[model samples]
Target: MNKTFKIYAVIFIIIMVILALLEVSKKEVTDWRKNFDVNEKSPFGLFVFNKEIKDLFKNNFTKIDVTPYDYYSEKNKKPHNILVVESEVDQESWNKILDEVSKGSDAMIIATRIPKNISDSIGFYNSKISFEEQNVLKLTDKKYQNDFIELDKFPSGRGFSYIKPNVQVLGKTVEKNNEDQANFIKATFGKGNIYVHCEPLFLTNYYLLKSGNVKYAQSIFSYLGDKETIWFVESNTKESSSLLRFILANPALKYAWWVFLGGIVLFIFFNVKRKQRIVPIIEPLKNTSADFVKSIGNLYLQEGDFHDMMAKKAQYFLNKVRLDLLIDTQNLDEEFSKKLQLKTGKSAELVNEAISLIKKAQDPYAGVMKEDLGRMNKLLDGILK
Candidate 1:
């Protein structure tokens, strides 16, 4: 390769090596799955609640883990309070929860967004809250008054607004002008109350594990009262493929696999070449008529047959006259000479002289000298010109 091309290739290889090394040396951060699964180790999971608030729940109520479908399937006579965190319930699940709540059982739903039917039925609408920085949350409820709870910067969640008359505002954010926007609301239906908290992230491990933030979550649980059984609904429903699950579970393997795939793609891209078939060469045909005639004349000269050579020369001359001048050669008399002279535009004397030489060569025993052949050749050359 040329010097410039070699340098470019070296630079490319170096860049690829650097990128591969960076990828290999990279460290994965905490998994932090955004779902509110109680079983997961992610920051948004309820593992912290199970660890810190389990004893508190044991003292006041029974904590049960089950799906909405399973909870509604049980026909027990016991009074149970439902708790859903960061989960979207289908229409059937919503109907089941509504039925349970309408039958004098309390329920608390903490999610970024509640179902539209539930929101409309509960007399509140939730909307996304955007802020330049993190906002602090505080309990506005008279019974569980606390200091401001500092949340993370750029919290990813929504907030609620009370639309129904007599709806109780349980909590509000302490950030500047956002104080009037309610984040938690309690609405009474037939005989029980439905507590809806927009900021479900408050109950996550990331916030609860933070110093003193656990009190903010505990304050919300105070509204649950003395219900016998508390059901914790699982919200993460999307199942990942086995390969993706494995990669996501192992950080080192994920990065290594990506680097390996990238290298393989680059190798194939540079190494690939186009293949073509070879073409053949061909030559034009050659005319050997003149060469053949010269060889025959040479053979006749070697044999000393002047009559045959002169006769062939006369016949060839007459054939040329017949073809080129379009004249009769059967009879080489004076009349024929006159006609040839007219067609060739030559003097009658020269035409008659050529005819006389041809007649002489036609004789069987005639012998032609080299000087006579030269004279005849000169005459034919002049006529051709």
Candidate 2:
């Protein structure tokens, strides 16, 4: 218990010191627009932040910052409505929001563009551009009645709208063409409410400095005002989990390290400062020179290499016989043939050719062919017989 306490004390001190240093150095989140010096804020702070959005939602909505990192905790919190803030929308994530909203929950999305595939899935009415508008508008056309529910009407020429099943256009862009205008729309999926915003500028830091944006931001939250629970979803999210907390909570994962350490310690204990056990060591006996040659010769004989060796030995014996028989050293072939006929009952031709073959074996590159070796063996056997 005392050792464990010491270990924990050392760990706590180290963590405190590291955290203190981090607190001294403020880092910016590069991808996101830094609003109000994020270095001054907690690393976990900020969800959807822009100067324009901060000013608008700053007063009414409590700053409850949720992120993908805090997904499980926020998921556990079970907010009344979830807001997904993304620069782009993907089908899977969009579908997830829709499914959640279909349960009568509320979800709001703020993005640059929503794909036509998504509109097709939820069944939205497609409208061609008639003209450009500056103020947010309502489509008074009766044909788009089932497709759009106007929250605010554009003042002059400001908004573009599209209609589809279960979806409605709330606001449109006046500065750009109908196809090019930024659109803010809403759709219903299952039991949930989904709000889709076209442009991020209206909620960003730069746009918030403008005059009418505060009202725009207010109107957005007002439409979603009743959602008790809220979430901000980043675009194209796959399921993920928190690593540190997960390992700490799972005992089996933690125990694996202890097991590994224990095995290593046991190995060290067995290896060092351990008593040595005596064992017998037998020395190999070395053979003499004659014994080595005899051993090699016996091996060759057993393995059929002895047949070629025997043929050579027989040829050497014949050479000695040639000297003993007194054949001329230079013309031994014809002279040896006459002497071989006189000494042995074998043919002179066979004896003369056999002597030449054995002499040919003296060539460094020459070797016995399988058939010649077999013939040589037969000749030696016959001569010996």
Candidate 3:
């Protein structure tokens, strides 16, 4: 290969080598984003919970990709218990879930904040821990009613400031102020019941893997009915509306995007490093304005069309008069001659003579030869100048 090609090839190879080394040596970072992805193995991800949830519930646990509304409305299969774990449930899906619930499908929503419709209808709202970094969580069941798990920092939990009397409080947490706040509850709607829990972080991989919190987490899931459950995986949303994140979220597209970025980096590095000499800008050949006028004049002269040429010259002179002198030459009469003289400060004789030639040129019957054309041109030029 040529020397320049060899240099570029070496640079490309070196860049690729560095990138590969960097990627290989990179430390694995613990992703703490609370996206609740069942496939993710991060601290806050639910990968561990998803694997063990079937054994915990004593049912066929499956992660569904569609919304609860779609699963319930479209399919004719037997009802499956639905679990929604999200930071917050939007109103639209909340309404759809309620519709499905009215049809006798049980759904449990565990979120940091309850939907407005649920809060307004059921009167269960989120509450803050009344104390410091740690809170004592308890189950209200007869067997474990007095048992409480102490967590390092329980920023969020289900039982809060208000609980409607109809709903049964299954679990609660005690703060530093010695007041018990409900975090888990069951409320009936139509033919089915919804288990609404305030704290979603309780069931994540961190709590499940650390400090025997798995027992407490399972205690909470025991409240769900004994049936096959479908974890509507839409609740694992990253809560990002960006287009790039959407592309990066898919595995196939994510690698394709990285490859595209690598190509762009190579293109920028090699192309920018090898700069080209300034190319002399050959100025486009100028077109003289006189060339167009000369060509038209020559065509008229060769055709021996003196009358046409005279008509054209008179038209040009009238346009000039209107533009430069601001005088109308439409009539070309005595009044026009007077106005032209007043506008141009020209002699009345010159103006009248020019008007007479223009009138002859404009008239069809007034046939003109080459001699007449020359006289008209000379007189018109004198008046206009």
Candidate 4:
């Protein structure tokens, strides 16, 4: 790998290590948002309350995932205390709850506000904004008149701004410096009672988390006697499941999938083989075999070895004659020259002279001269050309 690649890989590794350490060492912060989901464990959620609600009632306390309208639409002979916490009751649900209450089924709905239509019909109105962030409540009844519960961030939105004469005030906000404001009230229609509490945040985990504050909730829930209460909270009614949904439902699998995705991204980042520099153009070297042979010839000529050179040339020419002209060089005589003349299509004088030179060069004692070598070479070229 190149120097640049090595440096980048080191930086990438360092950054990854730092990120992993920070992720491991980071502290988990407390969530204070008012999400009233039954499964949420955050401070202002209903996880704790839902888990411990069964202790408040002695009879069968069933949890209905469906809305009150859907639950009450069917025939239920037994009396049940319907409990709905931290939710906006719709028109159909409100009407259905009223019908259920008229049929001797009690419903206690705790919410910051009720439907305006239902509020207008019953002459009960709750304010949408509360100037006070904290609240203290006092029960109006003579038996629990001195009972007071200190609360934080009370009237999540607002308290009861107006209450009808027929609806008896259950509890009111009391402050030494301010006048009392109606926070809780109950309206009796038929044989059952529909109690509306304006502060639903009081029943969340933040309040019940403290041992002392659990009583504040229990005191408020005391109105819901030991009867089978149907707790209706938001629920996912979806009947279909997707592959991705299944993976996300499991924490370990979800994190593993995310890690796999991250690995793909890192692999793509470091896969730099395709990002190389362009290659340089290079002309190929020319053929040098002919030049090498010319150099050897020049070396032999510089040595002035005419007799040896003549003998070497005679041997090579005779071999060529035997192979190409099909004339045997076993004897350099008149018959051989005559055959070569016919095969080579050369003059009789040229063929005869080359044969004579070959015969002279073959004799070692003949001492072939340079002139003889030149004339023989010319004669051989003329015969072969």
TM-score, every prediction: 0.54, 0.36, 0.56, 0.61
Better of 3 and 4 by TM-score: 4
Most accurate candidate by TM-score:
4
* lDDT digits (tens) for residues 1-385 of candidate 3: 5697678768766776676678668897877787677767787788888788878877567777676556656776565577888734456667877776677778888877775557656556645545446777788888976445676644553357777788888888767756678887888887788888777777788878877688787777776677778777764443557889889777567656766786787678757868689999899887877899789879888999888888989999999988998887667778887888887788987777777778888889887888989998998888777
Select the stronger candidate by TM-score from 1 and 3. Answer: 3
Please give the lDDT score at residue 124 for candidate 2.
Answer: 51
Question: Alpha-carbon error at 136 in model 2, in Å?
Answer: 7.0
Q: On lDDT, who's better, 2 or 3?
A: 3
40-92 per-residue lDDT for model 2 (tens digits): 22222232353234344443333334443344324543335766554344456
Query: For candidate 2, what is the total of clashing residue pairs?
Result: 38
For each candidate, the alpha-carbon lDDT, in order, equals 0.72, 0.52, 0.75, 0.77
CA shift of 164, model 1, Å:
1.1
Give the winner by lDDT.
4
Runs of candidate 3 exceeding 4 Å displacement: 17-21, 60-62, 76-80, 87-92, 129-131, 146-148, 157-159, 235-385
Residue-pair clashes per candidate, as listed?
0, 38, 3, 0
Clashing pairs in 1: none
Which lDDT value does model 4 have at 331? 79
